[model samples]
Target chain A: MKSNDISLPTVPFRTRGGVRVPHRKTTSTCESIVMTVPSQVSIPMQQHIGAPCKPTVKVGDIVCVGQVIGDSDQFVSAPIHATVSGKVLKIADIPMTNGAKCQAVVIASDGLQTPYSELKPPKTDTLDEFLSAVRASGLVGLGGAGFPTHVKLRVPKDKNVDTLVVNGAECEPYITTDHREFLENSENILYAIVKVKEMLNLKRVVIGIEKNKPDAIELMRNLIKKEGKSDYIAVLALKASYPQGGEKVLIEACTGRVVEMGKLPADAGCIVMNVTSLGKLAEYLKTGMPLVTKRLTIAGSAIKEPKNVIVPIGTMIKDVIEFCGGYSEEPKKILMGGPMMGIALTTDELFILKQNNAILAFNEKDARLMETTDCIRCGRCVASCPMGLMPPLISRAVKLNEIEELKSLGAMNCMECGCCSFSCPAGKYIVQTMRTAKAMIRSAK
Target chain B: MVGKLYASSSPHLRQGDTTRKIMLDVIIALLPACIASVVIFGYMSAVLIAVSVVSCVICEYICRRIMKRNNTIGDLSAVVTGILLALNYPVSLSPLIAIGGSVVAIVIVKQMFGGIGQNFVNPALTARIVLLTSFSSKMSNWTEPFAYLNKNAADAVSTATPLADGEHLTSYFDLFFGIHGGCLGETCVLAILLGGIYLVARRVITPLIPLTYMGTVAILSLCFGLDPIYQLLSGGLMLGAVFMATDYTTTPLSNLGRFVFAVGCGLLTMLIRQFGSLPEGVSFSIVIMNILVPYIEKFTRLKPKGFIKPKKESASK
Candidate 1:
């Protein structure tokens, strides 16, 4: 499966209510910064949010850069690969993002990354072969969900997908690696989109981007226009909204079709893929390399210098921090994703994964939580929530541990967009409580 | 540069809105009514408003500082409470009572209960009730609006307000245009309407509560031949429908909740007006309905999707 220049259609979609988040894009999105493989790479088996992948290779086993070290039997889990041709030093539990230890494969890099088996084009050109190839390569969604890509590509027979939506929205604040990747590797991504289309046997493909990033929109538009393929492949410029990058919201905004809650986009006759994922797919198809590296945004107010670093998957957070000139001061908190939805990592020993999009090193000021006071009943939360859920009322129920009230109030439907919390004047933790409420409701069920 | 990143609760964005801004908007929305009161009731309206606003501000400042709390009277909520309380009183009421009402609203009702958004009851309504019960004579003293005007005199005639226009209800034009005299705010229909329009346009408050409340009352009164126009233009109905009934702190949370609250306020207002001892019933009705807000919200809760669906079972299970 070499990179074939095949014609494919790009579907354009809209985005919901976006806040004007400070870009910090110039520091990271302007150029690609590739970090050298660390001397000792601590590769975690279960970096993404899913069932932990079991280690296939043990401690003291010599492994090459592309060799799979961790593979899971579960369909939802992903495998971990060695980043450098190296000797495995340890296979033990280490700190992860969720405040618990997970098994990791630690290797001492030999400074030579020659693969044990040289990567070549896929031997077969069938859909099954492509699926097997994708499974072998260990690629996930890469836009942060980290769902096994092979699983997503396997469309259910009941739902017929007419278009493949490539989400280039990159709508999250302080993250611009996807924008940079699209500008640098538009052709590669296009090839990946075509391959996806071929696999799905779909005729149309679309790329949705927010209008704020005019450069990305203009670049993609010009690239498609220059190829004289505007009809088949087009760029859609969506109005800016936070969480507009979410799969369901993006589907609704772009296609004007509401994918009912608890249903996939396929239920709405659509499949969404992030631009970075498609770019990696293109690379995998062309070079037959396993998913070993990813583009991550290293940003926040505390970092000395913020930039997008192309680091091998499983690289330690500490190493990445050093590569970014270390923290301006000891960061008050380290976050694994964007501010609105990111998980707070207690320790910086967490490893980067395909799903890890950004590492935010925020100082005390950035991590300051508003002291929740009495609910002012401003109804601002009601007005600002894109999902149309009343956050303050739901939060009240959650704080009182009223699960039934939460369920009735549609607490389960909250996308955790943080719009309610963002707009609140009483400083109540609306989203946090809603998250807890959602968890309680799900567990009760 | 090493900058201190502000760590707040979950939501970091404030939308640049503050209690002060909302209170300021409330005060601004009340401007037309204040001006109308001054024009119709002469210098008495101006003095009462000034005395009430100043007393409330001073009392709020003292209470907040004495409690070692953030002095949020700067937010102008005290000013709003002050103005609303004063507007509820008669133009003939001594400036001392207006100031006293301001103190009661700002100190006893608002600040004592935790300031701004913390009060369980509408501060203005609480103060008005307190004053009415405490000084019935002052509260109910309805005057000729401008010191017993004689028809032969050159000065403008300030007839007893619509409710007090003897047996016949005042003309629709006189009521709509604010010719009759009542309390500082209740006297002017045009002023209240203009303020409501401004509030709606600025998104300070939704039209649901005001429109629904007024619409329900007008429809019911009209059906009973109670003169919808005069009913709308009379007493505290316009002011209460536009302002006090829409108090964010005491009202329901959802659009549906607000609608229900408005409807309830309307029905209660009409029932009390037609049957109760009082000529007007807006104040008592709002207070009564405020008690049902939590229950109203509960009954009107929005059911989120997939809330009722059972989780999918694994193939192994």
Candidate 2:
């Protein structure tokens, strides 16, 4: 066996366990950006992980650019705004993957460039003023986890936060929109990071980029020198690893602190935000434009032309595909995010929400649906698991219906990072079984 | 490309290891033992092994089909069970008796409880014990190496295995090379070594179970004034340590658990051999340890994150 290609020098910064996934990045990484516009947009009222925003406008109401369509009921949620000047078609429920439907605001674009609200850049701003501007503009993390940026900036009183980590580790296989965003909007990203750090009353800030994307690193380095702010901020080269971009892992990699299990990153005196989220924040702070548009990567073998596109928040994925010259072949799987943590959509009717970063359309040839077999108890899953829990054992406990055994094996501790399932040779849906066990234990508790 | 699309949870990637692949690896590791059994115990040993494997597969198939579950006999785990049972039996055992052991292993011990990992005890060991109790004379019919008139032997002369001497010394090489015989696959030390080495190389069985188990047996036997080498080489020590006790599902979770399990297996095997009614106790010892796996995992519950340090305030207290 070849040992040279397998060893890692920075194990602590990354993880010891990750499968060698086939890289489909070459498909779209070189492609230039292509903007896509849809005839109609159906933006979901709730795209983030928190509470859904309530609709502010009912059916037949005309909504212009930057006009709030759905108002947030909670501070954690981001308000939805119209990407185009349009008349509301309906505010109805659309099917989601969770098997339930969520209310979405549907609008037909009027093909007119209409601006409802605008503001000039402030000459001098305080942290409180900037935060208020961010919250009022309805900016949220555009990097899949639509965490409200302002809320994330609100550091707890008990702990002192000194570092703000920018998550540019787009470790997922196909999605390179983050990689592209870093390359294209380096100034904005750096500015956003500085803005967030200032808001948190922190001086130390680091942009952590996976070594795989050296270009993004180079861009940040050049911009850092050009901006002459290299002392306060630096680019940390994180070893390329799956789930390296996970908040906990990123915290450990950047600041060398383990976010204790069952505790938030904020508990460890750190906050990590995605690079695109920073760019959106920068856009909001500068132009006073509400977050009504997002950058999405349209790639995979099914797409005739693979490229990154800045699309409206509610643009249909099918429209984006058509804008990219339409599909050459039917897709075996159409994922809304990256392959590792992305959700596969059964219908294109599932509009691209604010949280969506990539729309992957892989043909049948791209998918390798492995045949599942009974677990041979190899204990590889146990060894390779990042959370240090035994997946194979817990999965066995589940198979035997031994709930007590499952709990004892720490099934609940599973992060569902998919590392166990990804590395399992038995093709035993070990991750799914672990998730099932965790669910059972949770429900029982 | 156009199959029925289904939405499932994350971790779309799966490990290639399967129960069938694991069982096949075990069978491959048991190859040296099989060869030794055939060489020492004659064609009857080979015939018995074939009978066991076939019977076990058939039984597993029947059980699964009857229960309306997907047939998993193709996984070859039942074959491992069959082979392990056959290795525990004497060469002179009839095909029907071997089949009975296989049936017990697959139908009663394996499928009846839920197949593969769900079995409470090591199925093959349990089956072997059942066979020993049910067919005492046949189970104990030891065949010495080169005893039977066979094509491989230059001279034909019937003899008893070195263990049958009641208490005697034999050359270490003969025992290690498996010149003496007791059971079919248990006759040759050379074959077991080859299989064990293969399994180790493939990483199918960790060294903790076999090494610790054998070490425990050696230490215990030495304390009791028995020849440590003889105790380690005699009967089913190699076969049991390598194949039966290292069973994935029946064993505990961690290395610590495995070490404890192995030590327990070894101690029990030596105790049974020295004081109990059974002259060889590998199967019985492993079955006993299988029952303790759950408790072992419980006691060794990973120490969590804070339970170890108690946040430094406990240090002050």
Candidate 3:
């Protein structure tokens, strides 16, 4: 055969493997409507990932919106703010969506959202003031990972942080809260970007958005152009792939730099922030308000009127679902975030947390799993794993309790993205098996 | 909500491709080759295929029953193994011999090692090797195309395959169109190519192993001053490369590992064909490579992204 007939063009960037999950962003165009204030709110004291906060207010005390109801003395935690003016009813332990029980402060709303009179904009004259202001605003990663924003943004003095990656790649299915925030709160997001740039003296800022959201990409590009800082701030359109919004993946896509294992993005001279978290931070910086109300996308097969709603933090999922026309059918499963990485809620009575961006409820037809069979060793799980770890081998290691083999396979690097399980033809719970293996490794260590 | 809600882990969605669907695709891809075999070798080919398929299924069902395992014959994997085993044998082989091969494949090679996806080697190839060693003279009897359909002829005589001796060469067109004497599935280049193309299109198997294996063989054959096209079209290279060597459980996981495995199979096949006493080497080469699959996978395991390999020694020292 002739050489010309046999030569094939090679695909570029072939190592970056990820599955293309469906973008069920039904509420992307729906304007967010403020939810009706609930008669009672049970704000959990442990919403963020670090130290859980303690209740600062006792029962029978009156609290107002923007009032600090719970605070933590630990350096890694964020304080909780009341979303409505109400009488503290009780302080009791409540079950969280992940099946953990945490102390929650319940308050009966008085129908008046009384703003705290002590609210005032902080001084932004210095870097310390800006950092303290971000911490006081009680902002964490609103993109599902509840890592405290102040802790993430604090670059060590020994390291030089030069880039700020504003993650707009909402790669999850059925979640469009970030897209809506980009469209509706564009100004605040831009303000936050500018403030962050000024505060950190960053050289470059990249806003990475998936290609599925053309309007959001266009809007962000236009905003950057209007600011006349196109050279410093650029909007990059990436391929629409699941887990493209992951911190390490985004860092690689935007900067062509890899965040080494067990290292933060700062180690690669980059600090990543979610789009919605930045918007909330900007709003707080200007209005002197903390993170109380959150914009969420209520969607999935069980939801009758799937739309975007802004509800106060700690609003019961039952009340939120009722606000969106209630369940059309019996919900077989309720998730607290996007379908891929969302936490399944055991009860609808579980309260929404600060990191919840979407609440998905699926009927029996959509939620039922297939009968699992023996793995045919098709290698689809290996191909679809974004982390490049072999889940089948990891699962085998777990079955045999081979800790050394598990470590060699890089089981600790699994972020539990669910791509392996989703792409498996045998319907194997690949991610769950990896999770078990990871736990075993941890215990062994 | 009206009833108890179901709560499990994340990833509530699936790609919806089942193992049965994948096996069905493989069977569909093999159809054109089956038709070609029947057309060239006459009704005897059809009879052999039928006997092999039925016996393999029965054997698998009986074995699974004895083992108290769920019946997996529904996945169509047993049918695939039967067809592959039948296609690898000459049409002149007796029905009893074909059934024996099916029993060895399904009962001993497949079930004894656990069913589909658990066997360390391709069941059909193993049975082919076993039959070749046990009944060499009977297994080597090749018949000319359309001879069995000739009613006026007294008897069709056994003929030598193209690979048996260079003097038994036929026209390139006859060889390419599968009118020459050979195994049922290995004769027709056109039929096997069509089936391989269908497989690649449906993505039931990646083209990596087949392409690399065939490419290595062709290059090595050219270097040895042999007619590359003849070496490729003769023997069981096409069938083994396309079907046998790509068996999922017997192959490596990573693409890099697959490349290494295919290259190793190609090298071994060329060495055996050129130096060993046997005229054909595809089955032996693939079985050997299948035995090395776990090692290949271990060495070629993909390094996780952002993983830095620790240097063994300092360069300065």
Candidate 4:
């Protein structure tokens, strides 16, 4: 009998587990075209993760572009800026995509984008000055988390952060805004890396990009080489996997250091920033413009002309869909981001927030979910969970209201990456059940 | 803006796999064994398979109706159980015994425990055990291949299985090609290999359980100064390792759990066959291991990545 010759790798880097999501980056090569200014824009007071901002401009007040229309004294919140020169029409409550109502300043565009008179670059010779400028620029994590950038960059005194990790993976399916940013804004990103390294006195900076985006990786490597900072700045090509762009996963993938549970990236000696966030920071340093406009990818099954566009922050989703050549069919689902971790919009009236990197519209065929069946205990969910948690066991515990079991299963560590739900052959809502489990665990505590 | 939009949680996309597709793959993988059974046991094998499959489906439908639960026969899990039950029986067994086994498998073993994935043990294996204990004489009555074509042949001949001690050893080629008397599915080594390969390729069953189970059995047989090849080819080892032991509901959820479960199954089978009164031990070994799945899973639970176990304080005087 002839034995089959099958050789396996001796040492596999299986530190993180994630599924290979389809990279339907249709607009990767599409140059970002400026979207037509809407007749009116509605800027929500709350865009970041912390306390909601209070409206500073009342109804009928004239506001210029780059002017802060809303501000919050909270340390973890970012101010809201006007994306167009307009007259505030109303300060009514608007429904957010997450089903929360927040105060929004609705403004009528005057067709004249007047720049704010206070727009000027600030002197940043010290770290405090640099942090203040970032805060004044109204920058948040543009990778879709919407975390206040200044709060994230301010490492606590107890922990040391020596390495700066730039997240360029863009691993989600059907979103290529970051890839485009790397290709078009490589210089600005490199400049921001240099500035951040000097400001924080960091020793190394690593940019993690998935191997699927070869062009982005090559461009970043060449830029780092050209800048003569190859020793300080290295581009690491990661295996294409969903949620590789996650802060914890990216930190581990680039540095081989684990961010302990319930601990920040600073605990691992790393501060991770999104690629577009860094580029926007560099742009703000040079142009002194607040984060008022966003570059996003608009593509899905329902879209007629899926492409990349640079639109104002307060643009309604309906206007953006129209800019992409209106839906080819009735849009059955509208999502604020990529398919894996995006929030489904109940109504198209929601405005594009600062952190939204993609707006997807799916027709009936792509939107309809498969009928959920019984979990066959196939172990696929366990094998694919990036956190290494057992989704099936946690889901069962949730159904039975077993709080102790849920806690022991590490339900709180779940980042809700949707890998378990996506890989389930039975179409089980594994992530939904895990969310319920996490919520139950929290309440029990 | 156009119509009522469906709103749900995150993960708007699916990997396009369904229960029906997975069940269909299992059925496809079992075809080669089905064909081989019919070839070895003559026309009676086909009738038994059809009867078992129909009876199992009907029993599942009736059970669901009585329980007021949604019908799950469309998933074809009941059909797989039915085919597996029939394949485990001797061709000379009466049609009533086959239907009885199917009912036991679908209703008593499966649906009564809250249907497909909720069943604790492999339904087909449980049904085979029930039939074996209740109707031992009829279940053991074996017939020669093509005996139906001979008018003078008896209905059944009390023939010893290949696993029986003191029986003349069959040629390796005949054993591999399934020319001797045994259970329908366990006869052909070639056919079982083809089906096992298909299941592994379709990813319906990972090779962890099957490989570890067979490897342990082969090594133990050699250690006991028995024929390793005979031990692997005879009895229901191939069918149980490939089909029954790999049943999704009964097996553990982690690969480490499965590896331990497979090793336990192999060790128990060796102990039962060598010392116990039963000439065969595949079904017994699997049933015992199935009962220990929870403990196996608990002991072998994977420590999540980046999880740090806190230090424990020693007990002081």
DockQ for every prediction shown? 0.31, 0.26, 0.63, 0.69
Residue B38 lDDT, candidate 4, scale 0-100: 92
lDDT of 4: 0.87
> Between 2 and 4, whose lDDT is larger?
4
Runs of candidate 3 with Cα error greater than 4 angstroms are A1-15, B308-317
* Candidate 3 displacement at residue A309 in angstroms: 1.0
Evaluation by lDDT, superior candidate among 1 and 4: 4
Winning candidate number (DockQ): 4
Error of 1 at B13 (Å): 4.6
Report the lDDT of model 2 for residue A169: 80
B200-304 per-residue lDDT for model 2 (tens digits): 898787688899999998899889998989888887888888888888889876677888899999999999989987677888888999999889876754533
Worst 10 residues of 3 chain B by lDDT: B308-317
CA error at residue B106 for candidate 3, angstroms: 1.3
Off by over 4 Å in 4: A1-13, B145-152, B155-158, B308-317
Q: Supply every candidate's count of residue pairs whose N, Cα or C atoms clash at under 3 angstroms.
A: 27, 11, 0, 0
CAPRI quality band, candidate 1: acceptable
- Candidate 3 lDDT by residue in tens digits, B97-205: 9999999999999999989889999999999999999999889888888887787764456777888865647777887888888889888988988988998998889
On a 0 to 100 scale, what is the lDDT of residue A412 in model 2?
67
TM-score of each: 0.83, 0.83, 0.96, 0.96
Candidate with best lDDT: 3
